[model samples]
Target: MSDYICNWDHCKFEGTKNLAIRHVIITHAPPEKVPYFCTLCSFRATNLKAFERHLTTFRQHILLEKENSQTKEYLQISTESYNVTWGNRNCDLTLKNEKYLYPEPNIVPVLLEINEDYTVYNETIIESTASQTEENNENIEKLKTKHKREMNNLAEYIIRLEKKLSARDQEIFELKRELRCNEPFIQGFNEMWEDQVRDKKEQRDRKREDWRRGKVAKENMEPLGETFSSPPSKKMKSLVKKLF
Candidate 1:
């Protein structure tokens, strides 16, 4: 660290190098004098690095200093710039120049007129902004309501679809159960049909055998009748008599 000059002029207080540096940064660099203002608290800093640190501290102090006049004004300025960049740009030169060279003839009168114009414009803007804000809020509320309705409809549709799917699944499950229950009956019916067919074939075979036996008996009877009807031969008869 380097030796630092006491920010207070005519003060013979020689401090340690670090202490002197801190004093210069806290007192001289602060916004009370200029050339090294802290961006945060607007306090003057002796060095750029110190100003940067002060800015950080100022950010930390934002919530605490929110009600502070200086802090509130700064915040308002920042907010105003954010709201309307074009207007802010147009006013930038006036704000910077008004602080310097105040009593000059042309500049002073022009500055006053410009300030008056800015005030009038700002008032008009505020009035219009209030109405616009109300309209925007109404639109936002309507949008939120519509979104909620749509979400509810979607949820209901999903629930209905789930119920339908459950019903379909139950139907499928029942069909499977019925198929299982009928499997044994179907098998038994097939077995019975086969048995009936076998029985029919056996009956047909028995009828054919009976028809063949009747045909053979008729043929034998005819031959026996013809033989019996014809008389015995004379020689056969004579030989029969001698043997008796």
Candidate 2:
């Protein structure tokens, strides 16, 4: 068998020349000066390959809490615009609340106001003169009664439409309330998985250290027969003489 001996000074390591060189290098190095530093933990590695292995097994996550402080800014409608749009519109609705008109009472029919939203509020007035007091007066009275009934029907139809719109706006408001929130969900972390990985790595490192120590001890101590070996005694000489 061929023997490969290490040529390093005072190094009796006989198998791998590189292992002896590494041992000598580590022995002279400062105890506190380890090669790889883990930014997440206190663990340090001896070599680049070990450092990379350590990183893969001992990786950790950093927790960061972000503040959810942003809020939506909505335009506030001016009072004047509100009055012209909704309030003033209601003023005309109030006038239409009492649509009946009488010539003797000087109650003029409501004048129609056409709004930007295409809604029209109407007013109509009629007058009877003393000179036109003829037989057609009764027919005119019938016409007035018919017009009044038609106006009442139109008013009720508009009111029902407005009520439906109000109900739709209420539904929209409820949906918006349900969707609004002050806090938002963030990314999750798994503590149990990280802990398991850490424990497994620790077990592997401990076993490796124990195996290395045993190998070094075996190399340094000689075998039992080799340690006690000597020249043959008188009994060994007689046995050899008789055999001859």
Candidate 3:
């Protein structure tokens, strides 16, 4: 069989099909759509500024690789209790494909504080001052598990609230049809209301999915339960006042 030639941009990699695919995935095809995130809830949508600093560090690391910097050194400040290890060894920042950044939940990365100059890099470090403290990995895993459970509960609650809102919207449409209130103004109002609700629902759906996948941004995590609080009751009162 012929070798698989990777022609992605300036990449000159040639290998077997399996190797070529792996290279593409590890080198170029990280889910760039999903912003880089820590496995633990240590850095998430709630802490936008700090998480952004980590991203800045990621870019700096990529720049270093491009420049072919030799013997680069970085200080890793550990925010988590555990030390991150890569392939049975301490992580080398020069290696861009960090073991913890992968989504598999197999590794927990540590958080770092970046310096102000040199376009200094910040990241979640796994290898620590304790020299790869392997025992604390379980603590990271426990935190992640708890975080996932809480988020799932919140998502389910919001979904139930959305269902109630949808049902109320349907009742409004039925009332309009039953009253034969096809006045131009009424029709226009109904259309606008439908459009608004549709947009809101779509936005909520997208946010829910992103939250589930741990790819959500800051604003998307806002507490939506407040938006639905007694909305149905208030809408019912308004609907009656309008109908009469």
Candidate 4:
């Protein structure tokens, strides 16, 4: 990575070797044919295409640097002279001796200022108008798209909820109908249980009465048997013998 040096005056510029070479080709060379030497880098371009391509990339940098320096420093422009220095030692160019070399304009210092208020205002207004218009258009499109999607989703949700609610109502109705159908069977079971309890109680009462009567008869028979087996009393025995 060699540092970039402007070929114009051998002054070093802040760039890579490749960029420097590109700058040289684009800024100084002719379109169809290569220049014998580069105006900025002093490196020669063999073909015009390479030169044009180099200039296209380097031109922006050159213009920006010139614009920045034009305020603080003066530019040395000479139509008569091929070699001229621009803004200190950063940029220098040498042109071939041609009719365009000694053109009408000579090197002069330019004073920079922001004097035109109306032009600035007009430019600002135009830029603001364009930006606002673009933003509004974008917002409107987004809103329309978003509204359509939300409406669709809401419609689907409502339909699904309605289906769920209907199913629930149907289940409740079926449960109520089942309860009503079972009412008669439940009443019949209650009646049969009451009848069975009444019959059992009556049978138990009859058995208890028969046991009491048998106990009384057994007591009376024991006394009669004992008397028949016993001897008679003394007085009674005498009476009985006389009678016999």
Per-residue lDDT for 1-244 in model 3, tens only?
4255544444555555444433443344323211233442222221234444543444333344433222323322223222222231133111222222222224344423322122212222434622333345456668879999999999999999999999999999998897685677778999999999999999999998988778556556767778677356887899999999
* Candidate 1 collision pairs: 29-44, 29-45, 29-46, 30-43, 30-44, 30-45, 31-43, 31-44, 38-43
| lDDT scores of the candidates, listed in order | 0.46, 0.40, 0.46, 0.47
Error of 4 at 239 (Å): 32
Per-residue C-alpha lDDT of model 1 across residues 94-178, encoded as one tens digit per residue:
1221222212122211111011111101111244545665576678779989999999999999999999999999999999999
Better of 1 and 2 by TM-score: 1
TM-score of 4: 0.27
Off by over 4 Å in 2: 1-135, 181-244
Give the per-residue lDDT of model 2 (tens digit) for 1-244. Answer: 2123323234333323233223322332222332333333333333444434433432121111122111111111111111111112222111222222211212222322222221111111112322233335556667879999999999999999999999999999987776564213211235666788999999999999999999999999878896568677899899999999
Winner of 2 and 3 under TM-score: 3
| Candidate with maximal lDDT | 4
| Residue 211 lDDT in candidate 4 | 85
Q: Pick the candidate with the highest TM-score.
A: 1
Arranged by lDDT with the best first, the candidates are 4, 3, 1, 2
Which stretches of model 1 miss by more than 4 angstroms? 1-124, 187-244
Off by over 4 Å in 3: 1-135, 180-244
